[model samples]
Target: MPVPADQAHPLTADVAIVGGGIIGLATAWRLTRAGLSAIVIDPSPGSGASLSAAGMIAPVSEMSYQHGRLFALMRDSAAEYPTFVAALEADAQTDVGYRETETLVCAADPADRQMLADLQHYQQAAGGEVEALTSRAARRLEPALSPSLSGAFHSAGDHQVNPRRITAALQTVLPAIIRRTAVELIETESSSGTAVTGVRLDDGRTITAPVTVLATGMTPTRAPLPDDVPLPLRPIRGEVLRTRLPSGLPPLLEHTIRGIVTGRPIYLVPRADGEIVIGATSREDNREGPSVEGVSQLLRDAQRLVPGIGECELTEVTARARPGTHDDAPYLGTVGTAGRGPISGLIVANGFYRHGILLTPLASRLAAQLVLRELDPPTVPESTDHPATADTDHHHLQTMNPRRIAHPAAENQPQGGRP
Candidate 1:
């Protein structure tokens, strides 16, 4: 007899991913390819931060003075994106809108030129390629740039992707079971709290798994979990606006344009479809209604960078919350101390901040390596134990015989029984 839609059989898999964002879906897809049965749970899988992101794969452009480890990680991830997206597209038989263009950092005022110079110096010191140009030369590359533009630096390695297209493609191609429901994870034993034995749904039904990954973005911050396994994450809200330009709008911007004003960064991303994205204002923990002030602030800054934007059509406006972590880097790898006893099967792939889309490929590979324990070529930082200290010395990498956790098989098992 077929199970009714209202009362379907409890689904079981080798792994269960709690979040359906890019990281979660990527992890699930990798697990499935590795011969592990996997499932992803989320109400809106791709519409979170991934959808709202500008998708800039910029390790050099976005680098700051602090956190060298995070920079190395971003660089490694950016390097892996091209091949990763290729394989993913081949698997899905679809296009992901991967754009391989350079990014330009510009300064609209003379005082801001020093900032661009400082950034160029830092890039050179880090052994990255950057080209410094005067206002005229900068305008030569992007004619739409204002005549008063002081200076610009170009990072040729930086690129972008259409986050919406990638997300939609993944959701369509991934083989894992995807459900639209809220999942609550519960620890079977107090001592092994990090080991998620199973998850309970709203209707009082339970599904168990040997491995459960928490990629629920900020939602897990509100969930009940052991103190040791709690996520030290917060939400940073950002507002963005999109505009449609008339035909032959000068192709004013070739690569992504980022400008610094009042010590804060604002950016304008030009799409192949004549849509320019001008964004964004960062606010701390405030999800209040959108403000005209916020939109005006972005427009003021954008118009300062390129006066032509004043005439563009305001197509859309939206706001989203980005997950931030205590370490300022994403929280990856296994949670809790290993070898204490029965290890908790919970793995964290969250706290990606603004780099989620850019880092998806590397994050997916790392998560898959951790789960499968298999060594494969082109895998950066062979050892997953010391993720923060992984060597970025080599441009290419691989991993070796990872340990695999054994799980109870569901063959001839009763429905609703604990694993």
Candidate 2:
């Protein structure tokens, strides 16, 4: 329970996390365990884009994440899931629904078949683990799959977790998660330059801290940076549906199904509780809720690859706007991370796009690592255009830096006439 502004005293912490989503809360948890006082500011946490996540930890399927450092970051994060979830569950005292099931990427037609093969080729080329299966082989693994589908690729190590449960568990351990939105970042002058001092909440309550993290996804309601820097945060709306398995339908799928209809990916995640989540439709139009066409398309595509879906009961249709950067990569470094480093006080860990759920562990780790100054931050990748020669931790950091998108030229130019 958080104290209301009227009754609350001036609170402070070692670090102030400005979003209660998985990344922010998880980072708070780690900081608390490290003996650092932390507070999470979000009116309603875990109810953002996380609500619509399919929760598939498939590095193979998300090969490049629009193709960049996100690929290695996702792969590394997926590798960390087993141990990370185990520890998180132990601490949170709740079952986060971390099931280690394989993923099957199914196709619908000749073009889709070639798409599957091409994905396999890319995955293999990227040194990811994937196996090609004929249509019969795929059905053998997941009999509920349509018999007439073209082909499929299986990633044996991929798995799924319930994002809601994960967020719930995180909240359990992070009781101090403030139920108010942060309205601004307090900054102070430093030898290195401008550094974050704390955050001011919407209720006019202020919490001073040495460090502040901006984990607010999609809509960065208030930007802490100076007028010079360009955050360029855009919203990419997505829609997903949840269904309960009906009794008389084909047996619930045991493997995660990732189907490619035309070019887009349709993920069907199975839960231990007779729930199958069918998602998602990616659209550039930034909207708040699910549209009729978006939800209809998901059901239509899902049923095409797994006909049994038609028998499932529609339990939910969720929609949210994901945060996308101009570079199409996530921003995971300090406001000054990309060559602007002396801005000491702020760390940004948002703009994860569609990979937010999969990137939680790494993002949390990064937040703690950055605040502690435990290690020298990784090199900032020159540009998102080139593929990383190595998948080192530094490579991941360099690629996801928020400063990458803060265009220097655009920073100084006044916007049209608006000051």
Which pairs, if any, clash in model 2? 64-67, 196-345
TM-score of each: 0.84, 0.89
Instruction: Assess candidate 1 and give its lDDT.
Output: 0.69
In terms of lDDT, the poorest run of 10 residues in model 1 is 398-407
**What is the clash tally of candidate 1?**
4
The C-alpha RMSD of each candidate to the native structure, in angstroms, is 7.9, 6.4
TM-score winner = 2
lDDT of 2 by residue, 1-419 (tens): 33343344568777788887788888888777766777888888898888778888877787753484457788888877877798888887789999989999988988988877876777788778888899999999999999989899889978888899988888887747777777777878756567678888787779888778888886547545666556777888888898987775555789999988877779899998889999888788746779999888888899899898888899999888888887777877665534444466677788888888888877787677677662123223222222223345566776776655644433332211111
> Least lDDT summed over 10 consecutive residues: which range in candidate 2?
410-419
Give the alpha carbon lDDT tens digit for every residue of 208-235 in model 1.
6677777777653322445544456678
- Per model, state how many residue pairs clash: 4, 2
